[model samples]
Target: MGSFLGFSALFYFLLAINMGNLMVSFSQEGLCSAPPILTSADSSDQPRYWKVTNPTLSPAHLQDLPGFTRSVYKRDHALISPESHMFGPLPYWTNTLGAYLITPAMGSHFVMYLAKMQENSKSGIPPRDVERFIFVVHGAVLLTDISGVTHSLNVDSYAYLPPNSTHSLNCDTSSTLIVIEKRYNYLESHIPDLIVSSTDKQPLVVTPGEGYEYRDLLSASLAHDFNIYIMDYKPGQFLNVKEVHYNQHGVLILEGQGIYRLGDSWYPVQAGDAIWMAPFVPQWYAALGTSRTRYLLYKDGNRNPL
Candidate 1:
């Protein structure tokens, strides 16, 4: 019994030392604090999808190469992950929150946040002057538009709030939302009214390839200055067509695994990865693995080049 106890004590001593070393390594990789508590529910025994991604466990690299031009904000166009407590509650969000503020250095024209809210919880109150486009990724929500009409926003449901308009977003169930916000560039034309719709109700417009599909959340019009949409690609190669254009984009990979080429680098991106693309930086994507890949995309629209 004495020998057994001694051996057990020695084993734990070694284990503690190893854990300390592991924690130090994580801190060196830019962790603001200790690693997340690993419970049996989220352990290796569980499937990868069930496990949460910790950026400290899998650090993202910087993409500011010296070869790129200095025209943009250093062009740090790279994959963003849920790092540390950076995925904390959003301001004005009551009850439960773990919204990832996924805005990259794409200038002041646009920003986005990915959130998973629970019942009774509410989305952050939008600034009165900011135009917002909210897309429901999963579950549903009750959005009371500025005119006081409550709309049931279910899966794939989206709402576009014009500038200076107010709305209330309360959960119908545990829901995931992609909120894209931008400053509306006003023109002499009439301002668009509130738009609320879902993807299933909209027609699928095939683009470029047979497997590629698109769902525009909002229509093209002079009254609107920005647009949001979803692009679905089946399992295959679709990265051959690299595009370099003047329109910057904020992208969220909604589902499936894929390789996304942004600027001069290629990143292995999966579901929930947020990406920022600067104007004229080459961008493309390819759906990999066995499932279909879909991404919520945003871009400035209906404005003439100055």
Candidate 2:
């Protein structure tokens, strides 16, 4: 009887040890499942979609513009004057999720923090004065227009809204959307033109391709603040010899890899990279590997004489 009791106790002890080891292994695996975050240094050093070949002209030229002068343009272009002037980081809000506002000091620009909607909530966003270009960064959303036009968008999908256009968004699943607002007056001498789909039924979808394909989201003559475009580049394709005539443009890489030539230098670019080019600079790019390259293009300043 004593031997049997001892044997039983040993068996229980071994079982408990095994269970503990299993728990520890499961915990470690769970921790590893989360995605990795990029460090600030890594982001700064990452390659961009456009390389600066010309040592003389680059997006850095905008820094040479006087702050006071830029401020004046900000006031003239934006509907709501920003509380601060220096353009580093903007204010943000948090509720169930995080949201950051990127309000530029000049050229009627503001990007809204991504928002989250409750399961039963009927509306995703409140009515606002500024026109918005909504880009889905994470998850999914169902956008419904006042006329009952419904759009289901996934990550990287976007929608353009004119001023006073009534709409609501619904997130059956969790989502994060970036809303870029144009603050310039449409009645002004230079009203930024909104790029509309040639077909009213569907939003123009930019798929993976070889050559760069762009549809103007907004024109310079229409809005003095900025011009927006949706551009796509297919695998092994590129923009070989193109010159940006007017306005400093910024490229936000949304997908894939490519090599950008800004003058004499070649730079490798991947997803999430951003490159800014000054006016009159000649530049081009080639898609890398088997992946197609895609990006959002923005140009700010006055119309250039072509």
Best by TM-score: 1
- How would you encode candidate 2's per-residue C-alpha lDDT over 1-306 as one tens digit per residue? 999999999999999999897788777766334333333533445333221100111223343555412111122221111221222222232222433323343332454443544353334343455666766656667778767788877765677676666777777655555555655445545433333232123345443533566666544354445556667777877765566565555565666767776655566665544454545556777888675677766665453344
Q: What do the candidate models score in CA lDDT, each in turn?
A: 0.71, 0.52
Error of 2 at 151 (Å): 4.4
Off by over 4 Å in 2: 1-129, 144-151, 155-157, 164-167, 188-210, 215-228, 261-266, 276-282, 299-306
Which candidate achieves the best lDDT against the true structure? 1
> What does the lDDT come to for candidate 2?
0.52
- Per-residue alpha-carbon lDDT of candidate 1 for residues 1-306, written as tens digits (9 for 90 to 100): 999999999999999999898798876755565444444543445432221222222222222333432112235464564332255677788654665444544443577876678778886666766788988766778999878999998877888988888788998467767788776778885687899888778788877644578887788888888777788888985755678877878887776677777777777776657777778888888899887888778888788868
CA deviation > 4 Å runs, candidate 1 = 1-76, 83-85, 96-100, 104-108, 208-211
Q: What is the TM-score of each candidate against the true structure?
A: 0.72, 0.48
Model 1 poorest ten-residue lDDT run:
51-60
Considering only N, C-alpha and C atoms within 3 Å, which residue pairs clash in candidate 1? none
Cα RMSDs, all models = 9.2, 14.3
